[model samples]
Target: MPPRRLLLRGVLTAALVAVVSPFVHVIDFFYRREAEGVKRQKIANMRDLTPGGFIYFSYPQTGDPKIDNDPFRQFVLIMTEDGQLRVYSRVCVHLWCLPSYIQTRRQLICPCHGSIYREEDGVAIEGPAAYQSYPTNALPMGKIEVDGNGDIWMVGVDGRIGYGREWHNIKPDELVRRV
Candidate 1:
């Protein structure tokens, strides 16, 4: 390429970066803040939930009404018959519809598309969600643990939330900040 054209290209690239950098930084900042906030969110007391029972909670409660109050942040905590705890995002992987747990069937069913997920694993076994690829077909899962006081705390979330952060499963000990 000629010197003038090369110079113009470099200048344009630099200008684009300069314009985009701030937005990128702002997004990264928000994502980091949200990730840290979700680290130890107390969902419910283990004693309050019985086998085959479930409850809903939200994560990354950032105190921003728009972001925090969105239904996509909602998750369901289910207590299995063996007393193990499992939490899955209510947002259906198909088209962002909310899935409710059918206790009698032990499945999460999305009414909008009829996508069905197995309660034990959050895997889509039927309908549109089942047709998607891998993790995209499965509901995002939140990791939880019972504290010494028997309070169930959501520690981390696995997979991508609805158009949000791609958070990997984080252990409780790995969280250095509390929100």
Candidate 2:
């Protein structure tokens, strides 16, 4: 009721707002996302990998050395028979060993568990899938696109990212920047 008391109350309210406003902005950082999103890395050449040919590379090349041990970070590009591009995660569906393409066999074969996948698309054809406790699931594939320039972009990992469980599936087009 006193003017002095009213002035003190006003000061307290202003101080409270000053302290809490930043917290509101911090909370928004976690919840708010822009309508236009991030740009994906152009990891490989589309034309270089002819049908059945393969090339290996890392995705999201952060400066962290600890990343060297992550299996999902590795990927391979395979050109399909019709020249459609497919980026297959190198980490095998079973036992998490990196699978390599055996040019002679014309398939991506896992050395650790002997799990095999077709080069064009990841399909479980043999190996660990036959065992009761072993996995029969196909290796995760990357959603791919060939831009107008004919460069291949890894848009997103098709399923849960390799053994690491990171998801990079923000569609490649979402990250495209306008000139």
Clash counts for all predictions: 0, 0
Residue-level error in angstroms, candidate 2, position 147: 1.2
What's the distance in Å from true for residue 99, model 1? Answer: 0.5
**TM-score to native of every candidate shown:** 0.72, 0.63
lDDT of each: 0.76, 0.63
lDDT at residue 133 of model 1 (Cα atoms):
71
- Give the Å shift of residue 150 in candidate 1: 0.8
Candidate 1: pairs in clash: none
lDDT of 2: 0.63
Q: On residues 21-55, what C-alpha lDDT tens digit does candidate 1 reach at each position?
A: 87866656555655543567788886899999999
The runs of at least 3 residues in candidate 1 whose Cα sits more than 4 Å from the true structure, single-residue gaps closed, are 1-32, 35-38, 63-66, 163-179
